[model samples]
Structure formats: structure tokens, C-alpha cells
Target: MDSTKEKIFRCAIDLFNDKGVSHVTLRDIAEKVGISIGNLAYHFKNKDYIIAEAFGRMEEEKMNILSGVQQIPSFENINNQVEPLLNISKKYRFFFLDTVQILKSYPAIKHKHQAYVENSIRYVKAVLDYSVGSGNMSPEPEDDKGLYWRVATTAWMHLYFWPAEVAIRGKSDPDIGEVKKMMWGVIKPYLTEKGIHNFETIKKEMYASA
Candidate 1:
């Protein structure tokens, strides 16, 4: 059973996803959750407070998923990590779909989100680093460390915003698997011959399964 706070958290996401963050009020959340405004205020008095809690849940889950992958990652391990976080993103679509204000309005959430972005970049680069060391990926040009981060950031951008991008495009939301393909494709250019074979084989499987 969801506690009152948990109930409010979900109700808040539903309202924010529908009416948007800017338009929702405390009373609206209380009404939806079948709680009085005074009762809801005990948990969260404002949108920023509620959203920070929700964002905390989302990031905690994402970090927990990333933590399971270990510091070293193979091509397939990297693909596996994306699905978990992407599902979390879909659940809290408003966070990505209508992000600017909520982040701006809540500096702590904004800062933590920035840290998550950095952590994701580090994770991807670590995978590439391991792949390069093991001869599964091409070496960075002149051993330039910046190159890895650039590639990682490109991949992260797609994972972070594919849903929001689709929303802006007025297109159907791509499935989590499709988003993974788009994400993997960003770094596909950096893979070695063996890595390419694995990438292609798995890509087809994901496409087929989806």
C-alpha cells in the first residue's frame, strides 16, 4: 500500500504530466489524492517540494541501476543499463518532457540532475575505456580523454531526451528498445570489428523483440 506521501507523489506526476508543472496547484494534488489541502501540506506544501521528492526517486533508481553494471562494461552490458533508466524516465515523463522550469525552480534538483548527467557520462566513458583497453573499441585519437566524454555525452543526450524529442516532434513515443537503438547508434561509430558484430546482432534482436 502506498503511504500518503507516496500516493501524493504519483498523483502529482500524473497531474504534472497532464496539466504540466506550471499549472498544477497544491489543492489540485490534494483533490486528486483524496486528501484535504491541509493533509497534503503536511507532506509537501508546494510543487517544488513534491517534484524534488519525485526527482529524487527517479535519480535514486537510475543510480541504483547503474551501480549494478560494475565499473567495467561490455557492449551488451551498456545496452542493458539503458532500459532500466529509460523506463524510469517514461514513468516520470514530465521531468524530461517539461524540464526547464522545474529544474530552474528547484536548484537542488537541477544540481543533482547535472551530477547525474556527469555520472552517466563517466559510466559510458568507462565502458568505452574498458572496451578500448580490451581491443573491442577503437582507441581515442591521440589518446585524447576529451574524445571519450564527447562520445559519451552524445549517447547520453539521446537517452535523456528521446522521449521529449518525440513529444516535440508530434511523433509516437518510441519504445524503450527503440530508444536504446538510437542511443547505441550514437557510439556505434567507435566500435571495433568484433564490437560491430555484437552491436548489430543485439540491435536486430532488440528490434525484433520490440
Candidate 2:
């Protein structure tokens, strides 16, 4: 995309994240980009289009982050992944929250949101399968393995929603790390003895490097 269109999308994302789609006007986004409303409209026909494009951009960035991890992540690599996830949460928390809050107000967008959720589940499952195949995780029965994927994806989505509360409060919640640990607990029961040992070693290595 051209720089001008990129600037408009960035500005719109910021405004949507802060004030929400319903609360923000096209003029607000234009003012943010130091462009006339006409110029902004030249790139996007309407606010809905802009909102869709903003989310599309977010999805692109998410795919890039995931794709860059060339192998099953150890705890050290986990930290690198966490940084991008946290950055995304900080940047777009409000937009995500607002999208959920106004689901009834935009049925088309809501449908798209549902599709994205399903796609995310699939993407996460693929990653988990890759990790298990590479011996990062324990082998399990097919049924139980599917359940693990579901659990992980569900936990991840819940975590994404959490950042919205933090964004609204303008402070990091002290319990956030604990929440992450609890989510990890979902897979704890499924780990083999060797997997458990490896996980502990990985955690120790992660802490030592920290």
C-alpha cells in the first residue's frame, strides 16, 4: 500500500483502539493523520472498510510473527513470541474490546470475526502438531491431542481479551503472569514424564537467562 493509505489505517487503528468504532468519527481519524476527510475517504469508502482493513493488517502482522518462528519454540523462543503478542495486545486492545462490545451493531463484521476465530484455532492447532511432532510435547491419543489443541486455543483467546481490561485501566494487571501460568497448566496433565522434565529444564533455562 501507499504511505498515505498506510498512515490513514494506522491512525484509524489508534482511534478505534482508544475510542472504539462507534465512538470515533471519520473526522477524528482524518485529524489524527493531518489529512482532510476527503483525502481519507479517497482511500477508504467508509468507516467499515477502514475497520476491516485495519483488522486485516493486524492479521497480516500476526501471520508474520507466527511464520517467522521456524521451529518449535523452546522457553527462550517463547519469550520472543510473547513480546509480539504483548505488543499486539497493547496496540489493539481497545479495538478488540470494542469489536466484541459492538458485535450486534455490525453483523457483517461479527461474521468476519467468527471466521477469524475459527481460523486462529486451526492455525494454533497446526503449531501444536508441529511442536509435538518435533518432540517438544508428549505424544497422546488422537482424541486427547485434539482436546489439547482446543484447550490451548481457548486459553489464548481468553488471554487476548484480558489485555482490553488492562488497556482500559492504563496499567498492567499484577495477575497477568499468573493467568498465563494457569493457562499453561491446561497442558500439564498431558505431559509425559520426559516432557515434564524437559519443560522444567526449559523453564529453568528461561529464568536463568532472564
> What is candidate 1's lDDT per residue for 77-187, written digit by digit as tens?
777787777778888888887788777788888888888889977876777788888887889898576888888789878888876877887876657777787877777
Model 1 C-alpha lDDT versus the unseen true structure: 0.82
Cα lDDT tens digits for candidate 2, 1-210:
559988998888878776778888989989999999999899997887886776666677766766554354453454357557667666766556776665676566688777767766665566556657767677657666467667668756655676766657776642444444554566567666656776786456445544
TM-score versus the correct structure, for each prediction: 0.91, 0.78
Indicate which candidate wins on TM-score: 1
- Which residue pairs in model 2 clash with each other? none
- Measured with C-alpha atoms, the lDDT of residue 113 in candidate 2 is 71
lDDT of each model, Cα atoms only? 0.82, 0.67
For model 2, the superposed segments whose C-alpha errors exceed 4 Å read: 69-76, 134-136, 141-146, 167-180, 205-210
Model 1 residue runs over 4 Å out of place are 143-145
State how far residue 98 of model 2 sits from its true place (Å): 1.3
